[model samples]
Structure formats: C-alpha cells, structure tokens
Target: MRTDMPAEIWLDPYRWEALQEILEQDGTDIEEVLQNYLIEVYSDRVPIERQKEVDRRIKKERLAAVQEAEARKVFCAMHIREHGQEYILMEKNGREFLQVAVFLRRYLRNEFTTPPQRVRPGI
Candidate 1:
C-alpha cells in the first residue's frame, strides 16, 4: 500500500504560523482542508473529458482490486482423482478457477488499453 505524503508548500514561517492558528481555531486538519479545496477547484476548472478519464482510471483500479481479491477466493477443486490438494493446481484440474482467473486477467489487460467509461448526467 502506498502512503500518502502531505502536500509540500513554500510559504514563509509567518504566514504558515498564521494558517496553523486559523486551522487550530477551526479544529480542522490542513490536509483535509487542502484536499477539499483541491477537489472544489478540480470540479470547477477541469474539463469534463479529463474528469471522465480520471473517473475511468479510478473505476478500473477499483475493479482490478475487487477482481484480485475475488481471485484469491477462487474455488479450487479438491478431492478429485489425481488432484489431491489444489494449492498449486491450475486449468482443468481447478475447473471454474481457471475461467475466472483468465477472465479477470483478460479484463485487466483490456483495462490497460481501454478503461471502462463512467456515465454522467447531462453528458
């Protein structure tokens, strides 16, 4: 997992201290406030196509995560003849497991070329 680093600023100490005092009075974290401000600005100035691209990337990443988690839970056929434990088994030996793994793998591959698009209102 990637740790999010706080945004770096080049403000002088005087103004920085003033901002900190204001934030202390408001009981808000600077990072949260900055994030909200950035989001607001993004919504205001970013083009719809660019926003859609970002949305697609986020959706694709989320889909990939769900697929990977589900893959870890892929069903393995055990107790079958010649197939004792499916710990390292693949393909027909694992039946449905192969299809799911392959399907997810292909889906992610396609995502690399063409991420799934998001539907938006008034578009």
Candidate 2:
C-alpha cells in the first residue's frame, strides 16, 4: 500500500503561471497536462521491456494487497462482530502501542477534560 504523500516539484511561480495560462487556453488542466507529459517522457526514455516488467510487478503487488484487505474484512465479519460475549485483548511487550495511546491522549486532551463543578446557591 502506498500510504505516504507524493514528493512535490517546486516551480518558479512566474514561469508556472505563464505555462499554466498557455496550457489552459485549450480548456486543459495543468495537472492532467503534467501527468501526460511525464508519461510521454518516461515512454521516450525507458525501454518497452523494462516498462512492461515494472507494470507487471506493480499490478501483482497491488492485486495481492487488495486480496489481503478483502480477507481481513471477511475475518472481522466472521469473528469480531458485536455480541453478548466479553473479549480481553492481550498486548505483546511493545512501546509502540503505549506511544500511540499517549499520542492520542495528547491530541484529544480537550475532549477528555471534565467541565468545572457548579457552585452552591447558598454557602
């Protein structure tokens, strides 16, 4: 799974604006034009055999990932559904889980705070 954000290519604002205006004169989006341009450049540079091998690997990996996700959904549906049963989760010795809890607490501290108590009418 590709979970990380893509890297950005910074462009000169003035040149980019001029190029964008020219590109959009034909009702074309800059992103679409850039993507097509990249594909054209890659095709011109890379051999057909190498590109085919890379495409095959990408397809295999993505399909395997999709199948694993579907299997996880099936397992959860079969075993983890709401019921009258009690389940206790056991954690292996790891700081990762503890760190996640601490991070969550810091992120959501406002939500967990109690409201101030009301004062008595007559003290």
Specify the highest-TM-score model's number.
Answer: 2
In model 1, the worst 10-residue window by lDDT is 80-89
Q: How high is the CA lDDT of each candidate model? A: 0.62, 0.60
Candidate 2 lDDT over residue span 47-100, tens digit each: 999999988988888999999976665211111112443322222333465664
Writing each residue's lDDT as its tens digit, candidate 1 over 1-123 gives 223456786878898788888998999866678899988998999999999998898788888888987677634432212233212222333346567567456544654354333333343
Q: State in Å the error of residue 69, model 2.
A: 1.3
Query: Could you tell me which 10 consecutive residues in candidate 2 have the lowest summed lDDT?
Result: 74-83
**Candidate 2 lDDT score at position 52:** 99
lDDT of 2: 0.60
Best by lDDT: 1
**Model 2 / residue 33 / CA error / Å:** 1.8
Model 2 misplaced stretches (Cα beyond 4 Å): 3-7, 74-123
Candidate 1: C-alpha RMSD to true structure equals 16.0
